[model samples]
Target chain A: MFEKLARMDRRIIYAVVFLSLSIPLIWPIGLGVTVGPETKELYNTVESLAPGSAVILSMDTSPGGYGELASGAAALLNHLSRQGIRVIGMGFFDTGPSLLETAFGGSDFKNKQYGTDYVNLGYLAGSETAIARMAKDIPGSFPRDYRGNLTPELPAMEGISSAQDVALVITISSGTPGVPEWIRQVGDPMGVPIATAIVAVNVPNMTPYMQSGQLSGMIPSMKGAAGYESLMGTSGLGIRGMDAQSISHLTILALVLLGNVVYLGTKSGASRGGGR
Target chain B: MRRELPVALAFAVGVLMIVSFFFTSEPLVEAAKTVQNWGVIIAAFALGLASVNLIQIHARRIIRGKGLDWLYSGALIFSMIGIALLGIVRGPTHRTYQFWFDALFVPGQATVYAMTGFFIASAAYRAFRVRNLDAAILLLSAAVLMLGNVPIGEKIWSQFPVIGDWLMNIPNLAGQRGMLIGAGIGGIASGLRVLLGIEKSYLGGSSS
Candidate 1:
């Protein structure tokens, strides 16, 4: 049975992996998570925003990354809203508009009327070029709100136009034309402090901007989400996801170790048994 | 002529777009803006075309009696067409369209993204083989970072988080900054090449 199982097909391995993931998700083990510096920087950057300061929330993620970052995005929005900052939400990704609604609807943020306390600019087609044009003229790029009303007519956007009008810019993104575009086109020229929450894969690329002070800070993936959750003192998906992430990580580590050991053992045993 | 004229236009406009960056004249800027607007409209149409292509392929598969998963593809095409119709004809303000988007589109994306939690674990398992000295170091650092990112490691040993933070802040920053500088230089160089027509990758594939 052991020998037969040892030679089990890759599908079985996949099944095991799936079970390893699903079991933890079904019954999670709560592991206390410490907030790292990147997250700390993200928290502090938001905390430091002055009331009435206009901050552009570039919710540039597809719907898929929403589950991982939505709660953190919400907490960040709620924090900004509480501070009395005017939040302008824009999406580069096509699915961004719905994501904005998801993030906003989940909290007290819904009470904040659109085109007043906050505005959703919805999806703009061009990726990086849109950010570039936006830096040149905000209304010229996004002439109307998501609802098709003239943007300038909105009380929220009355004084808000261009990157210069924004005090701080936070880009919640899953990919490119996000933080980099913000840093180059918007944050740097306008002197608006910029921060980002990127998918984990993109974090390495974003760190340089943060270091150079181009991006004031960043939240890197789920771990960054966890850190933001910790700071907000409201446990959400980031915290819950952290539990599943930890268990799954541990399981992988253990499996790798076991696989290596078994391989080495089999090699040495075969050599000895064959009269080495 | 179907592909050639558009391809020529794309090449011409693409060149003008690059050229407009250098010259500050009103005509140049206007040309650039026009090019950009055209790009946007074309890109949007391309997205629609891509989706229609998917619907065609998937619907055909279903029609040919492929498999159980063919139903999944049917669901995809149905939802896509429904949403596209809603977005185009009925408008976003309509309650039925909003309901479909909010309920179906939003959750569908979120569910797919949530799968990353599982995928990341599988990837990490494959990554930690420690095949060489470099691999060993990378594995060790990953472990330190993982432990540092979580609080239990700090409770067990405070140094773990501190070391992890240092690795991320110092070495990670150094490496990333180096890449950024290299990238900036490359980007500018490539832009110059494109402007010179020495590089035509942006013009896209050959017109054949």
Candidate 2:
């Protein structure tokens, strides 16, 4: 029995985990979220943005990370919309513009008119170099918007020529040519405040930047998304997913404990047989 | 002359970029901006270069008609050209392109990412045996972190969140900083090697 238990097929473990994640997602337990200090800082930074101030929302992730970050971006967008801040959307990744379109289309910005309240400058081909050029000359770098309209004619592009004109820059990033790239090319060089909503895997790597005061705020993964949603008084997918995340975590921990127990038992059993 | 000219250009450009940061003179800054713009243009061209390379490799595979390789190669080529033509004709914001991206591409990527959860669970079950003190500590930390990052941890015990935050803030931050600093130093050394023409591997061959 012990051997069988120890040698349980991985398929069973996968099934258990899938159920652990899926069931809670279906019927959520609505766990109360404890807001992290970083998430709170992100919320406060956007809140503190003066009305009519423009902020660059750089969607630098593809769909791989979009699933994890979309809710956080939505919550942040909702907050930005409430504050009536102008958002200039741009991306370094090719898939960035499409992700931004989905984000904007799904958010409270549905009612907001494009070219007025918000505008997407589209996916710039160059990664860090594009960021540097945009910092120097925004209109020069992107002559046309994502929708094929001239950028200078857009209302949101008015009075916004470079990074200096913007109040803050928020990068929703999954990988390289992202937050660090932004900081190196635009934020640090131009003295613009930068924040990020990144995938959870990058949280530890980015925390030091937050500590060093390079990043003004950060939202760490889906849990941070849930915390931000709770603060906004709007329960979105992030809040919904927390139940699943919690259950999955517990399930894995239980599995680890069980595996250790089996290991110890097997070792002791072998020792006793040897003694006999 | 082939290597010397490229190395000299790189050395000059690298030095100018470094100088632009500290000096900030108008002409120097403008010159740096021009170089940066050139970099962007070159990067844009590199995308086209990559596409051509991808097509060439896939086209050869399809021509060879190797086992199942041709099928995948054909699919890849068709998808690439089809998507590109669609976008070129109708623009990316058009319904057809958006539909393909949103419906087909997004979910496919998300599904691939979501499979990590199951893999993690299975891997943890098989590998996280507490064989030694280091392994035990690693297991305990992973468990604590997993619990603490979610809302349920606070429910179980507030201290979990507190301890988790400490783990991330202090030790994690220190470790990450050490890595970042090390990487920065390595990058500078590599850059110097390139500038001095000591690193010719980037030129497609070993340094003499």
True contacts kept of each: 0.39, 0.83
TM-score of 1: 0.85
- For each candidate in turn, the interface RMSD (Å) is 3.2, 1.1
List, for all models, the DockQ compared with the true complex.
0.40, 0.82
Tens-place lDDT digits, model 1, residues A1-276? 324434545455556667765776688777776776767887788788787778889888887776666766876887787788888888888878767766777766788877788888877787877776666667777888777889888888877766888878888988766887877766765688888778877776777777777877777777777777778877877777776666555666666665556555655677887995
Candidate 2 lDDT, A65-123, residue by residue in tens: 99999999999999999999999999999899999999999899989999999998898
lDDT, model 2, position A240? 91
- Name model 1 segments beyond 4 Å from true: A1-30, B1-35, B55-74, B93-95, B116-128, B201-208
Error of 2 at B130 (Å): 1.0
lDDT per residue (tens digit) for residues B36-125 in model 2: 889988988999999999999999999999999999999999999999999999998999999999999999999999899888888888
